[model samples]
Target: MPDRPATASLDNPRYYLQNFRSVLRWVAGHHADLLTPQEAVRLAQFEALPEGSQALLVRMVMRKGDQFRASKLSYTEIGPTTVALQPLVSQGWVDPQPTLSLAQLFALLTRAELVRSLQAPLAQAGLKRNATKQAMLQSLAEASPQPAPLAHWCPGIADTVVALRSGPLFQRLQLMFFGNLHQDWSEFVLAELGHQRYEKLSLLPQSRAFQHRSEVDSYLQMQACRDRLDAGEAPAAVWPDISRSQAPSPWLESRRARLLFSLGRMAERAGDSTLARQAYRLSTHREARLRRLRLEEQQGEAEQVFCLVSDALKAPANAAEQLGLVRIRQRLGRRLGKTLERLPRPAAIPEIELVLPRQDSVEMAVVAHLSRADAPVRYVENRLLNGLFALLCWPALYAPLPGAFFHPFHAAPADLDRDDFIARRQTLFDDCLATLGRDDYRECIYQRWEQKQGIACPFIHWPTLTRELLDLALGCIPAQDLQACFERLLADLRAHRSGLPDLIQFWPASSRYRLVEVKGPGDRLQDHQRRWLEFCLSRGIDVALCHVRWQASPTAECET
Candidate 1:
């Protein structure tokens, strides 16, 4: 207690101009009156401005009752007199005491280097004044000389200014700068000492612009798959591990399901029946959950069942729950017998087909046969059958496969030759049907398109159908052969001629080339298709789908 440190007083004139310079620096880009006495004192220490100079500067900038009032002025008369002398002290030329002239002050203030040197002290002095006054004083201290702009007091201070101006803080600083010049400058000085980036201060999470959960999940899954592939593991073996290892997140369920489905397709393509089966099984489970959610939504359930299912699926030891889930599905099927009956046969063979009974089921029967088939031929046959199946299921005006019906054809306009057109249309329909009934449906379909139009038909429009067919074919063929076939198809499409009809028939028997009229109604070809098709056609390849109109009913008049 006896050795308590003595507080420095502001009465000494030796430190007066130095303190004044400090206050001016603090107020440069901020308001003055907002500074508290304690803050002013801290700012003075921060800028290393002398105590007496800070007190003098504060008194000169702020009137009584302003922020600097708390630090009572010990040399009030001397404060204004020193401020008037500031210009002279800044120039290194001393102003004689009696005739302190404004011209001499101006001369002193105009020296750019001297003014910059004076910045540190002014900034410190500004901190001691009321927050508002301190800021004004700081700005005046840093003002540019008439001939040359004021040099930045610190080397990187310009960068800080640029950053502050470019950032969000610029607007706030501008407002504060022009508003109450005293308070804002003090706050700015405090902010600088705090090393805070005013622009980056955000309160809202939405402003962060983070990636969506699904996107991130999808990327991770792909990377994991690629990593596995790089490790030389078969695609089929890698999928299950990838799916099982996924992090639990409701928003990522759909992405996870898609990844699993892709892996299943890859396994099937590689002729890894066991691996393919596993992947498909995982995908089907996810699909089933999605279907259940859709059903619940339709029934107006209180909570979205899919969200709960996703949570359950993400739980530890998820595989153990499979048996219970299957039993639940069976019970549900029994309870909703009529509803189950009305459900359309899944267009593609699912991985879980073996688990279900195969009576009158298209996917199960096809997939079961595909698993037993061999090599390139098996792959080709599966693709052919699946493609036909897809066509049958598709609700087009004229479907080539059995069990498909054409919405009644409308008669052409009276100006056109209706009879001739009808005969041609009838022949085309008959040929398509005949191809479907052949023993080698794949060759037949390909032959029909190739013989007629010298081009392959569009398959991308129906991704689900393509995926299903590809999976089945992969089960039948060796992975290398399957990949080659896919490449062939892609190459053919790439080399096909432009303006060729949309549908092409490939008949291997009678003619190697034929045109099939195919159309993806309301579907636009993507950039990939356009480029591929253009390349193929440029290479004299025959493949194209022609745009066509179909009448709604037999009684409706035909427009084309």
Candidate 2:
């Protein structure tokens, strides 16, 4: 088998990956009625595995549930090394592979997570428990790779599941599309509850109590509604119809908010202004309010929005929110001479020391030339292999918010010690970093780049990433810096990851780098982006937020 950069799946790697991704997408689109977003994701990941890995996966999968003992996966067919499976494990195609250790479990604990993990009796007894992680680290190594039962291994390929029959609604959907239900209960529950607390949602045979009650989730019930709407079903037929016997208690709080929000969206799309307005008023979410305001302007109900803004102006607001109020007043009543509050003068920060690019893709064009003029530079927007690298190096760092896997992303626990975080992270990184970076640290990232770009990709795989882009990113972005940057991103992805500077330029020959965030005219820094800029700039990472001002629109004849 070829070493790290290439998988043993196929000989013509590029052609195979492209064709496979295309075919997967085609199947997903054609069977849109038959799959959930998560199920479609599983199909792509499962098909991307190497033939040997696929065979080995069948062995492990046949024997256990979603996350079985990783120790059971050291098979002869896959490879001589268990590390070969890390790509699958890292990408979340295989539950990010857990290791058995006390410290690892500790690293995953939040106080909320801790309280939730143990009962009141046990919590009280163990709340004061302590350990020397550094001392514990010296003696421990990764749990050894154990052989899966060779007897359990099936000889030939299993029957290709083409159609799904015996199952629930979600199951039937997955079977028709991806051939299996890849979503586990944890993920399903997480989706249902969102950032709220975790509670299992199950269906029971309808009873007198359940006549007006809903044991099933509102979101789950919405599936068929969305499916019908997408299939060109009329809005009246597609919207859920609650029977007279059904309980009014089912839609409460957030459930009510979600239903009203969904109703407003559907009503607006169906051109029912009256119904949309009613639904929008009942929704508690800001998104619903914004959509309603936009709709009001569209339907000549601007007076309502104007009244809303006028009444709400007594409270504090941001510049963006204030500007929105200004627009509402300006456009109200269609009187050209009618005046409202003047627009606030937006702050402009001049970049006097630097010469900004005039090119449309200033970031890309500037960096592409700078790479040639000086050294290598690469654009890593969503292709954050370094972030994945950090995760791959330390799966325990996933430290999901106590039962948070089934809901929206949340911040890591605040009470974790800085030394402890570094210690736990370094301990995990140390386990494989040496072997991965033995010959060249650049190859370490490059190998992960291959995995992320290859079959182990978790999501809808990106358009084929180029070798030149890979080479420069691997060759330039320092591996040493990857851990620090990724740790910060993970520490608070909501704040840190998005709004990052667009380009990272590197002078590999001199071991130097700079981060550049390019902004078009009239674009100011977002709050989250400004946080990243401040963090990077304070750390002396040479980050620049470049706001581009175009001199003039280039004539088509002068276009490059």
Writing each residue's lDDT as its tens digit, candidate 1 over 1-560 gives: 01111112334443334433433342431333433465456444534543434444344343322121112334644554445334323431222222212222333232443345455655655543333433534455565333322223333222110000111222222232222122322333333344321211111222111123343335445556765765667785665457565444322443455556666556656765555555555653334343343334345333344344445445422222443343344445555452333433322211111122223533233233323223111213123422442232122213222211111111111111111222324444344444434455455434433232311123222333343344443233332332333333322222221223232233333333322223323545443344444434444444343333333554654232
lDDT per residue for candidate 2 within 1-560, as digits (tens), equals 11111112333433233332333443454444345577666766767776555554444443423334344456654573356455555554454323323344334333444334433433334333242334322222233223222112112322111111112433343222222234322332232334222222211222111122132333345545555656776656644452213324432234445555676778788788777776777666345665666667777545676677666555413333444555666777344345565665543332412244466676676565456656655676545543444434533433432221211211222212221343444555455455443556565545654553432222112343566655555565565555456656545433344666777777767767777776666777676566566666555566766655554544322221
Work out the TM-score per prediction: 0.18, 0.40
lDDT of 2 at 513: 72
Clash count (model 1, backbone only) = 99
